[model samples]
Target: MSAMLHPISRRLFLSGAAALGGVVMLHPFAARASANQAHLRLMETTDLHVHVFPYDYYADRPNDTMGLARTAAIIDGIRAEAGNSMLIDNGDFLQGNPMGDYIAYQRGMKDGDMHPIISAMNTLGYECSTLGNHEFNYGLDFMFKVLAGANFPFVCANLTKGSLAANARDDALFIKPYVILDKTITDGAGQDHPIRVGLIGFVPPQIMNWDARHLTGKAMTRDIVKAAEAWVPQMREEGADIVIALSHSGVGPAQYEENLENASLHLAGVDGIDAIVTGHSHLDFPGPKFEGMEGVDNAKGTIGGKPAVMGGFWGSHLGLIDLMLERDGKNWRVSASTSEARPIFERVDRKAKPLVESKAEVEDAARDMHEATLAYVRTAVGKTAAPLHSYFALVADDPSVQIVSQAQTWYIADMLSETEHKDLPVLSAAAPFKAGGRGGPDYYTDVPAGDIAIKNVADLYLYPNTVQAVLVTGAQVKDWLEMSAGIFNQVEPGKADQTLINTEFPSYNFDVIDGVTYRIDLAQPPKYDPKGNLINEGANRIVALEFDGKPIDPEQKFVVASNNYRAGGGGNFPDIGPDKVIFQAPDTNRDVIVRFIVEQGTINPAADANWSFAPVDGATVLFETGPKAKDFIADVKGVAIEAAGDGADGFAQYRITL
Candidate 1:
């Protein structure tokens, strides 16, 4: 005993001190490890839409706000703090921005060549992914080629192989309805438990209407909620401990009688679904507690105490859901849960900065592909004499849309070169692509006079749509404008106050056709359907139409230039279909816009006095704005700004009248 006590000599004491120092340094990590055993972290990137490398292909510049690279950085930091974690994408992984176009059309995704989106996703080791509506934009054959490059399982319950059974066998890109992954999680006792986590994916059925030509006879899509009900129970019967529904469909009210498109809340109420990851509306569900009615279990924030989350779109936010489970014998039941939305970038002094450091491996994987993507899109496609800006498109006459219409008309004009209708007067309808919406205030396109790069062309025509010319009557042309006027809400006469328009109506659908003159009677209701069918009895928004300063002849056939979607009975306008189509241009609207700019050397495609809102003299209306708009208000005519209200950080409000 005396020797043992004397063992605390200088040499031994120094060694003991060194050992204690090492333990202290490692204590924080040890405690963290113990705490993490009780919790599991899940990271989700939804609606990435081809932003893989943190660069805005439309802007042709590095954007810190978006991209899978920035999101990968955040995922790394989240994993470092959690005991166990998994990464997943919520779909809409394709068909947005110029990089997606660059890979799909320019570089071309072959069977072996790795697509940019697939390459970037592979770098992060995405455990699972779902299908989005945009995936069908390029048609089945092209989609198959691109999806073949992905290493992860492509899951979707609604889409099925139809009549293409033989083709499905030839291409292994066919996906299963659902997949059950056996994931092991360490419990509080430090025991590994094999948990069967079932994942089911759903895409909206509206693809049939939007991309019908691409999917015709090749594939079939079922309704989202119905598809979930059919497969979720099967997944549970497969010995799944927890079931997750990856719904590329969006969250709306459970009220279906009022609206058929509302599916999220209803999907949540479905049995066997433990949690849901939603997307497609491009909105963020910040917490498990959705915008449910009062007196509900706000704390749990679940449909039936089950968790749900919707990450924001375009890699803007990563959805995080933490579930706490209690063990009843060997079975696990979710006891408590919490959800949060973490953005990839945070604004500091009005500038976006990456919130975390990117994983070196992920960056290395996407670096070369990202650079090549940039170089490919940056190639000069054409030139423009005047600056292209969308400032006046929504509110008044705009040059931005005028240029697009000019391009469409010019392109269609050439395609009908050999047709008997070659000399027929041509009018082109185009909309503002950069109108403020999900892209935020900075979404507006403002290209100065000079070289119109390929990036600018993509920005001008965001979709990969080909040009088409419809044979429409003068009366039909008037109805077409009336359909576009649906973007505005009819103001009641003599009303003291009213909102100018229904903000829910997207601005991009508000078509402004060149080669015509008309006025939107705000008092009149819309006469056409979203698919371009005439429904209303006497909706006369376009009171008069003129060509070359002469009143349009209702019997005279005129070629109206529009995109393939609209000419193919999209937007539901009456008599604007393939039967009414006289010519279909080989060039896409994007390519035509580029060529138009190149030919002009400098173009003044400024919006002429084609249309305007009927004057509401002596009446005033309040218009909202961001601080950046204060300077631009002076440009608006006959409108007065009383004062600016305290709006959100990026938004400002103003009072104006017709």
Candidate 2:
């Protein structure tokens, strides 16, 4: 029988040779672990984001918190502990950090070129992988080039080559939707057995909205749950004994919604799937984040009665799933399953310390490429007069986000020259991508006053979202800001020392619309929830909104320049759906910001202070930011910000006089 790697004294590998007393055999699956029951181990690394080495190119320092090389140590240790194992990556492996930018912008993937991330994963001997949304950031040609060099099969059941009308089928996939591997396994009492293990993959359907520029006419996507339901049943008919799903999605509500971003929970409920691997949320499964979630056992890492796991992004964690399978006549049935996430670093004294060092071979795989990437990001592109920082972006008008808004407004004004919306006032909505929420305290942007490099641009704008313009009335504009105001927690009039920031709300969703002035009323409840659902139907948090010196006319029309994500129902803002979208620029927000900085040399960094917190009598709210906020506390407008003390997770506590 055809076989892959042989068992070496009970240690299994992925090569195609078997050795007995140091003598090689034709078939590697000759040894047996048990006669009736065979144990299978699965290791997953998701959202790698091209972190091949133990380094932070943005900070230009060695960071132990993330790296595929660091996670390789844990992978090796876990593989050593198991009898039979297979490694898989759940996607989001293409873009995120400086390394990814370097590959896309500097090193351009040619036909034969090996992507550094793929090169690193190749050395790790990955069995299979799926495409993430970020994979299309560089375009289809580049992704096809990267996939050409991958040793393992790439699968995505949702992404198809044809249009939506074609209906996604196994034959219509851009890549293979699923693969049934005729794996040979050993059972108890030294008996070799054959089993067909099916592996299917699914990415979020939002790729159409996120990377519409690269995927509009050529490709389309189907709903995750719908794709899994159609494909898993076909996999069973194709002689698959055990089926495992590689879901490049996040776990959310159990009730299925069409086009929902997070659909792993519902995908796991599909009948034929034996186990599931989840990602794209940049979170770990079985952690505190999933605690109390419906149909999820955090302790056992099971979702909808199926074993599931989501390894954290940037190689921070290695997801592990163990299955006990028993042979039943001609097929293998999963009897028991367990899952966990193993971190490469542990927090010590509010700092990350490497619990597992980088593996030697993994480091050797991409050392030269890593050094080249660092050099590429360090090249000076422009200069900044004042320091660009986002420590207090949420509390006050920030220069970092202000600069992006300024650039967007400038770009949109030029693009609207001949358009019908040219006469209408153009407002730019910019959000703080790195205000240190789930990203931790060190995640805030801190670019010093000097030459701005490509790394600074990457830090300034984290996402590769494209620039888009949404046309709406003044009333819809106010509703948009009201939705953004949900980032702040409601404070009582007489409440002192109350938390000012809503920790549950992501800083990225807190859009600060430039080209207008407004006040966020903390005394009033938010009109919308963090997910953009209208909760407080009649609640009004935005007060005294003005385009110039006068109150904004509710009936007046305006054009708001923002990213594609916001315009494509990402934040659930009212009247800002795709139908209202008037302008869709192919340029990414990062590129637009970079071009703006280059054009206006030696520009002022001072924020225009368009927004502020309205007065709440007898209220003194306290919030936490990076410790470096102490340097520019006085520059903050409207609010009275005072340094209280050091807060948890290396954040600085600040008191806000409202």
Candidate 3:
């Protein structure tokens, strides 16, 4: 057997005399022995979002909770046990945290100098990676530049380049459909056996909606299932033995009506896909069994009788899928498989402190980069007079969201001041970017009243979304909010509903236009398309739309403030298109938010009584919450908590009422 890796054996020497004294070390040999018995070990790091070093760029602190550093430690440990192991990332790698922004904006990615993510990834020796939708947040050119730094092949079957020349250029380094890995594995008899492993990658087709501007003419995306159908057979024809689908997509049941919207389950059923590795919803799939159907041997971690896994995001967990293969007269067949999503570090407190110590070599490799990244992110960008928080976003008008709305409005007003349509009223729509979920409880942005740094700006707007303002009629504006209201499910007047809204709906997509006052009648169904078209029979949910205390004029054209993605039809909302786009600002939303704070010097973005729940005065609604929110329950009037209950992903829940 190969030597085992001890990921947490580094000595934590105290300052002074203790530093020279003999150190106490935890033996990792036992852990290594346990893992070595597996035939083949597969490791996954998903939703890295450009967090190269373990440090949190947004907080400008040593965030032991997230970072590829800890994942590297786990990978090293696993590799020590099983000499033959593969490391793969499930995507969303390009944009999310501040390091991504720093590299994109400050240190422009060049051909040679390693992009931070690529730099760290190269150190860890990643085998291959797929594209997540967020990778398109930056334009294709920028994406190409950043990807150039990676040493491994970038695989995705759905995306296609425009010209044959471009396609040829991309095909050289960027693999279309998949790539085949010919590896040698050692058997119990200490003999080396050759294995042909084929890996196919897929991204959601919704990239067309999420990044239309960048992809419109330069590239195109196909549906995941269609892409798989076309490419998997090609991989099989290439004489590959085992086929694994690395889906930067996610798993969900077939919603007959919204079939094409999410493609995980549909893609899983595609022929030629032996095993599945999924991501992009930031979900953790400890095993192959999804949503109750269990033909998959999750204990073996196989999908459709093959091994599969999906690692949790932000370096929180490292997905380990072990497979046992039986020799089939010169080929190998899967005998058994098991999957587990293991956390690199456990949380010891509310501050996201790390409980498990990192391996010395991994820590040493990342220490300098982590410190430098932290120092770079901590430089003050501006200041704020109040503690910005997203605590009230889901329930009512929130100051954090108000600041974003203000930034959008201010930015759009300047950009539209000289346009021919300058006379039109300008309204801004912004959502809570830092609302907590997969990011954990402390994920919410809460910058105290003081000097706000670049890190703080990142916490405010996690993505590097550019600012865009679009011209639309009052009716279209109403339609936009109506689409946003789809996040909430209709609740009966006195029903004991435990869920408040589909938590699956991303908080950033739930735009709350600050200049408009509109009541969302929960009884009605969503009237607009995710692509912004009006469904004729859809319910009129945004009742009594008003601007500045008066009913909105249907024919009146107004400029609506939004991020570049939405103004470019990212959310599939109505009447928001490039044609209706009157202004496209160069500044990112994070920059605008920071500038707004600096210009105000002191901000009081308190919510005005513009909109409220209609006559739910006596009705109660059950809502789930995190442990961190327990302190804020007093702020919600007439709210009550039932006995505390377990929520998804280790979150705590409480029932509340109006």
Q: Which has the greatest TM-score?
A: 2
lDDT of 3 by residue, 538-652 (tens): 5877887888788998888888888877887788776677788766554568767766766776666655535555544445555554566655544433224453566667566
TM-score of 2: 0.72
lDDT of 1 by residue, 363-481 (tens): 67667767877787777655665667774467676767888888888777776765688888899888887766555666776777776677877567777677888888887787778
| Residue 438 of model 3, lDDT score | 67
**Number of the top-ranking candidate, with lDDT as the measure:** 2
Ranked by TM-score, top first: 2, 1, 3
Task: Arrange candidates by lDDT, descending.
Answer: 2, 1, 3
lDDT per residue for candidate 2 within 1-658, as digits (tens), equals 5343224334332211121123333212213335778777789999988898988776578989899988887766655555467899999898877777677877788899988888899988898998887888889998999899998999888888876544455447788889888777766565777878789998888777667668878888899888888888889999999998999888876787897778888888889999999998778987998889998999888998899998898899999887888888898898887788878888999999887767767788888888898787688767888788998899899999988998999988887875677799999998999988778878888888888886688788888688999999999999999989998889999879888888888888889999889999999999888888889998989999998899999999999999988998787777779898888764578878876877887656778788999999999988888888888887787778888888998888999888
- For model 3, the local distance difference test gives 0.67
Provide TM-scores for the models.
0.63, 0.72, 0.62
Listed per model in order, the count of residue pairs whose N, CA or C atoms clash below 3 Å is 16, 5, 11
Query: Any idea what lDDT model 1 has?
Result: 0.68
